[model samples]
Target chain A: MKAKIYITLKAGVLDPQGKAVEHSLHNLGFEGVTGVRQGKYMEIELATEDKTKAEADLDEMCKKLLANIVIENYRIELE
Target chain B: MKAKIYITLKAGVLDPQGKAVEHSLHNLGFEGVTGVRQGKYMEIELATEDKTKAEADLDEMCKKLLANIVIENYRIELE
Candidate 1:
């Protein structure tokens, strides 16, 4: 099974990297861009074929190592 | 308009960060994880309401600044 995870900063958190990208976009003349937020996208391949098990393991992974829960949020998709 | 961009290393390219993450996961006892690849996810907000124009501009942005086409690939999703 394969898992896709998206980890993003929570609302109200400051994102300097995102600000930098937004500024760069403007400098590159992409003036229509109003905002930019950066996040982490991860692809994980699991040996287990059980969808339920994979989902549980992935959720645990996100909680333990994949995300900074205090300031970020994560969403997972399995295939 | 909103655009979500995922930028990942090309298949043949080496990813040291990904390797490190995999190693850490293994040490952390996520034994079911066979492989891991890390990528960038960006949410971009555009002032323009035209989807076609936004797509074109986003493609240009990716080529010019958001992605290194030589060793990385990017997928854009508009909403």
Candidate 2:
């Protein structure tokens, strides 16, 4: 099985990288472009016996390291 | 109109950050997790007159700033 983790910064967080990208786009003549937010996507392949264990493991991973609880949140999808 | 940009490292590119996250997940007892790849997603809101120009502008942005042409590729989605 495969799992995908989407990690994103929380609202009101200052994202300098995203702001820079937005500015560059506007400079490239991309008219009316506004509000750029950046996030991370991680795909993990795993072999699991059951969904319950997988969910618990994923939750633990997210809380410990997959995401920064102070500024980011993560979601996991099984495939 | 809105455009989303997804940027990912090309295959064979070594990603230390992704590897670190994977190792940490294993330590957190996420068994059988393997092969992790990390990427970036940027959501951009835009008002565009036509798809042609939007695509051109997006292409330019990707080549110049939105992505690193040497090691990363980018895709755009209009919303």
Candidate 3:
């Protein structure tokens, strides 16, 4: 099984990288773009097929190491 | 309108960050997890509502800035 994790910055977290990218895009002639926010995408493959254990493990992984919890939130999609 | 972009490393590229995360997970007792890959996720808000223009612009953005054509590939989802 595989799990896709998306980690996004919380609202009002001041995304400097996103701002820089947006500026670059506009300078590159992509004038219609705005409000850019950047985050993390992770793909994790599991050796076990137990859905219950996977969910429990994923939650623990996110809280412990995958996310900041203070300024970021993570969502997991199982495949 | 909004667009979500995902930037991922192509196969055969080194992922030191992902490897470190995997090691940490294993040390933390998440033994069933393996093959971790990390990437970037971005959300861009567009001022225009034209879907065709958005697609065209996004392609340019990915090629010119969002992705390193040599080692990464980007996918965009519009909403």
Candidate 4:
């Protein structure tokens, strides 16, 4: 089984890195760009095919370390 | 309009960061996790809704900045 996790900042949180990227894109001649938000994506492979177990484990990982739950949100996809 | 970008290391490329994360996950008790690959995810908002133009611009941005084409591949999604 494989798990894909997306960790992104909460809506109200300030993202300095995203702001910097937006500014760089604009300066790079990407005039149409108005905003940018940056996040982390992880692809994990497990030896087991248990989707239920994988999802639970991934959720735990997210809450424990992958994401700062106080300021970030995480989404998981399984395959 | 919004565009989502996923930048990942190409197959066979060494990812020190991913390895470290994998080790940390194991130490953190994510036992089911066997392998991990990490990447960047970005969301961009544009003033224009023209799909064709947005795709072109994003592709250019990926080539020029968002991704290191020599070692990474990027996928773009627009909405």
Index of the highest-lDDT prediction = 1
In the order shown, the candidates' DockQ scores are 0.94, 0.72, 0.92, 0.89
Query: Model 1 over residues A1-79: C-alpha lDDT tens digits?
Result: 8899999999999999999999999999999999999999999999999998889888989999999999999999997
- Per DockQ, the best of the predicted structures is 1
Of candidate 2 chain B, the 10-residue stretch with the lowest lDDT total is B41-50
Model number with the top TM-score: 1
| Residue-wise C-alpha lDDT for candidate 4, range B7-79, written one tens digit per residue | 9999999999999989998898776678899999999999987889889999999998889999999999987
- Please give, for residues A1-79, the per-residue lDDT of candidate 4 as tens digits: 8889999999989999999988899889998888899999999998878788878888888998889999999999997
Which pairs, if any, clash in model 3? none
lDDT of each: 0.94, 0.79, 0.93, 0.91
User: Lowest-lDDT window of 10 residues in candidate 1 chain B?
Assistant: B12-21
Specify the poorest-scoring 10-residue window by lDDT in model 1 chain A.
Answer: A52-61
Q: Give residue B24's lDDT in candidate 3 (0 to 100).
A: 92
lDDT, ranked from best to worst: 1, 3, 4, 2
lDDT of 2 by residue, A1-79 (tens): 7777878899999999888877877777765676788888877777785788777777787788778989997888887
Interface RMSD of 1: 0.4
What shift in Å separates residue B6 of candidate 1 from its native position after superposition?
Answer: 0.5
Q: What is the TM-score of each candidate against the true structure?
A: 0.98, 0.83, 0.97, 0.97
Q: What level of docking quality does candidate 3 show?
A: high
Candidate 1 residues B17-72, lDDT tens each? 88888888899998888889999999999999999999999999999999999999
TM-score of candidate 4 on Cα atoms, chains taken together:
0.97
What is the number of backbone collisions in each predicted candidate, taken in the order shown?
0, 0, 0, 0
Candidate 4 off by > 4 Å: none
